[model samples]
Target: MGSQKFAVLLCADDSDYVKKIYGGYFGVFVRMLEEEGETWDMFRVSNGQFPEDEKVGEYDGFVITGSCNDAHGNDLWICKLLNLLKKLNGMKKKVLGICFGHQILGRALGGKIGRASSGWDIGITNINLQPSKIFSSLKMPASLSIIECHRDEVWELPPKAEVMARSNKTGIEMFRYGDHFMGIQGHPEYTKDILFNLIDRLLHRDLIEESFAEEAKSKLEANEPDKEARKKLCIGFLKGRL
Candidate 1:
């Protein structure tokens, strides 16, 4: 192949912090996953901008990003995005969903998504990986610490979907629907600074208690997410190297 092409269906708006620090959420994702000769384009699905039907097949794979909006909500844009996801699935196009993306993917594929009974799960968490041929080419430990910030999760998996990873705070932390579609509930694209900034935003918005914010920050100081490994896993899937 000459070069791989990819698109990011961004479902979140970039905060001023992210725009200044990482060039925006789109930039955050590209920094983590972009490879030489690969092309990355973004569609702000959060703003109702999406690839038209004629444009969907131009890329090798698609990535769905986290959003502050509830994935379980039936907003007009959300429904449109779900339809696009259904189309992509029918085509067997490779799709990677993270955070809100993960939850929405579950709903779109005949699963269930709801408020996490554990409430918010922030900071770093270690997820136990399951053995699968899809992961054979990449080196991974039994458990990998990853960045997490979500209040909703996949409550049930779609038919034929297999659980790939889980953490104490959430069940179905990661799942796969056939070889072409995967959903990860953590933020593999987030940097510590991004999480720090996010905590500040949540605090300002009164979405989290100060004590909880402090606790999440403290956890961040203790461990780092296995970002490189996540990068490899995502790239491998998109490029057929998995």
Candidate 2:
């Protein structure tokens, strides 16, 4: 095969702070996921930017990014995205979803998604991975630590989908639909600093309480996300090398 091409469908607007420091969320994701031989492009789906329907097959795989919007919302762009996801599924194209991406993908695949009953999970979380064949070659640990900052989650899996991982707070920390599509409920691309900034923003907007923010900050000070392991899983899956 020729060189692999990948796309990142960004579902969040770049904050002025993120844009100033990280060149935007797209840059952050590319830095984590891109390798020497592969090419990556970004579509700001939150801004209504999307790959043309006829151009969808040009990339080897696609990665969907986290968002502030609810996955269950019927916004025009979200509806269009669901249709695109359905198209991608029909083609068996590789797709990976993170955070909001995960919830939206679940809805697209006929699953149910809504506000998580467990409330907000806004700290480093250890998700228990099933010893499924998908991880046989990954050499992953029984539990993987990652950054979690979401209020919505997948409540039901689509037909034939399998739950790959779970955490105490969320039943579907990870899930897979066949070999081509996967969703992870945490931010593998996030550094602790990014999450910290997000927490502050959430608190400032009254989305989270000061006490909750303090607790999440303390947890961040103690544990680190296994980004390398998560990166391997993502890149390997996207490249069909797993």
Candidate 3:
């Protein structure tokens, strides 16, 4: 392919499996974008290492992927990433944070994030989008079958943030910062099989119970996409400032 028309940085702060699976998700996103005549490139930020300051502005937007690490921890890389996010937000650059990325965005934007009370580990849950310019082309009750593996949720929105979507399991499932930055707690990038494999691996490692795994699997199987809803959300994001 020719040089990318837009660049997207995928910040990965977890295991190889996260990178592998999320890469697949990015492929889905890229495919959707390409179908609409867009070109993009994806770069990784692993183990805290990332491009220097001089190269930060070369990209059109950046996406921070979910991680196994807790956002409240004192990891050096996490701190650095948070700082970088602040800088990017200050510049009004487009940034989309997913899962752990969502937690970090909340923390960076002066919001509080912590473990959920229900302790819900939603695997493939449906999201209800609120009426906004972001979902104008999408239908009401837009059910997005997304992978939700996060324990922490955004408890409070920052001064300049707006809550976009929510679910019964998680109160603040989606939020937008100022106008350009957005964070989603669920995984819209994961395919059904990929999501199942992830839950399976987690079960194998004893990270979750077998019962939970089975429930998640069933949810994955039952997930139905509102394609028009997703298309509208993506197109709105791409057309807006990053």
TM-score of each: 0.98, 0.98, 0.84
Model 3 root mean square deviation, Cα atoms: 3.4
Task: Tell me the RMSD of model 1 versus the true structure.
Answer: 0.9
| Alpha carbon lDDT of each predicted model | 0.91, 0.93, 0.70
Off by over 4 Å in 1: none
Clashes of 1: 0
Per-residue alpha-carbon lDDT of candidate 3 for residues 1-242, written as tens digits (9 for 90 to 100): 43324554555433456447555545655654444455566555545566678777766667677766777776888778888888988888777787877888899998998888878575667777776665654444555656788778888877778888888888888888777788888866655666677787778888888998898788767666454555456556755622
- lDDT (tens digit, per residue) of candidate 1 on 152-233: 9999986799999999999898998988889999999999999999999999999999999999999899899998888888
Better of 1 and 2 by lDDT: 2
What's every prediction's RMSD, in angstroms? 0.9, 0.9, 3.4
Ranking by TM-score: 2, 1, 3
Clashing residue pairs in all predictions, respectively, total 0, 0, 2
- Best to worst by lDDT, what's the order? 2, 1, 3
Best by lDDT: 2
Reference-based TM-score, model 3 = 0.84
lDDT for predicted candidate 3 compared with the true structure:
0.70
